[model samples]
Target: VLLGIKMSPEPLKKKHGRAAASGEKRSKRKPKRKETFSVYIYKVLKQVHPDLGISSKAMSIMNSFVSDMLERLAAEAARLAHYGGRATLSSREVQAAARLLLPGELARHAVSEGTKAVAKYTSSE
Candidate 1:
């Protein structure tokens, strides 16, 4: 009887494996890199909607989503650069990739914003 129920007459077979040897060398895996964007996401959300509140769970989801989106965008931009036979990624390739990825007025607005940002950054240096 097992747990007050009837059991099979034959006992379960035990699985066998080599026991761990204390002196044996084991392979070590590299630590995974963790990307965090919670604080940045929260700050941006607050800036855009000052009166709105975001739950911690929602913020975490948004952070992951935004990080993934940015990574995809950068990867697409790099692909565009490669397609253009250039080893280095440039602003032009990024702009072209953004235009290809974004639609209509959004593309225009994004390009303009990017241009403004580049100009500001260059002027600061």
Candidate 2:
């Protein structure tokens, strides 16, 4: 006795919309992520106030504040470098920019801390 049955010799291929239509395989790659300033904000908040908790709204506000400050500082630093005709912006330009951006005693404190940080980083290298 003989019964007829038919099947393709090739295994079935898994189909993706565009890839299948084009006869192309999907790439196996992880996506790159954009940088966020919130991580730095969280770290500093944790250090300054270990028991403190921040609301989402408050965190968002802080994120914007930090971002705006950085932008202003960078702009000022770049302007200083351009005015000085330097190809590279040095720590001195950054310190001057901080002073111009910040006011009075706060400016002095920030400059001092920045100087110490730069010195430590250079010494380590």
Candidate 3:
């Protein structure tokens, strides 16, 4: 008003949540999801197609696929261990499980990858 400019009242700001709902400790971050494979899935997808976007439906299917794969792998590994009379599971059982569950080249690749992971883990320890 001093400089001949009209000053207008600022529009009211709307805040989310209750004004008087006190005593609750809330975090600004999203809660960690039960299925924590989202990061891995996104990384794998990005490796194949950097510019590609995943739909929620496709992501759900991917999560289900990962869950099924893990279940089958674990079951097969446990079965192999049980049959071999071993009280503990080892890479051998996992390799055999992969061999039995996966087809041909995929099985071979899985064993190789598992071997690498085991080696890395052991060497780190």
Candidate 4:
């Protein structure tokens, strides 16, 4: 038995221009430059630790930390992707990057080991 269904096919409408097809108004506005990794990390830390006031010294240290981490991650990600014939990075690749950026050999090794533990846990689930 047929249910209560309207099975008539609707007519297609033709579009006039590219904007009409996409339904967005194209503008001459240029995209804004993204804030660096340092800027973003600073903003988040500031929010969480409000008493740690934003100062040149604080900003300088935090910015340097973030910049180093991001740069290392980028380089490691590129290397990993090259082996796979890809030119982009994954979250795991970013972890490798973070490990590379850590200040001391001990810290870097610790981070790498931690990352493996995390990956194992995530993959198991």
Best by TM-score: 2
- Sort all candidates by lDDT, best to worst: 2, 3, 1, 4
lDDT of 2 by residue, 1-125 (tens): 23654455886576655455354467776879856677888889999999998888888899889889989999999999999999898888999999999999999999989989998999999
lDDT digits (tens) for residues 1-125 of candidate 4: 24975454774465555454464455566889856555676678779996776777767787787677567667777887788787677766666655665668865785768678888999999
Tens-place lDDT per residue, model 1, 28-111, is: 668998778887887887899989888988988898898887787799999998888899988998898889888899999999
Predicted structure 4: lDDT: 0.69
Instruction: Give the clashing pairs for model 4.
Output: 73-97
Residues 29-116 of candidate 3 have per-residue lDDT tens digits of 6878685577799999999999999998888888999999989999999999999998898888888889999999998898898899
Candidate 1 minimal-lDDT segment of 10 residues: 12-21
In Å, residue 97's CA in model 3 sits off its true spot by 0.2
RMSD in angstroms between candidate 2 and the native structure over all alpha carbons: 5.4
* Model 3 misplaced regions, further than 4 Å: 1-33
Candidate 1: the clashing residue pairs are none
Which candidate comes out best when scored by lDDT?
A: 2
In order, candidate lDDTs are 0.83, 0.86, 0.85, 0.69
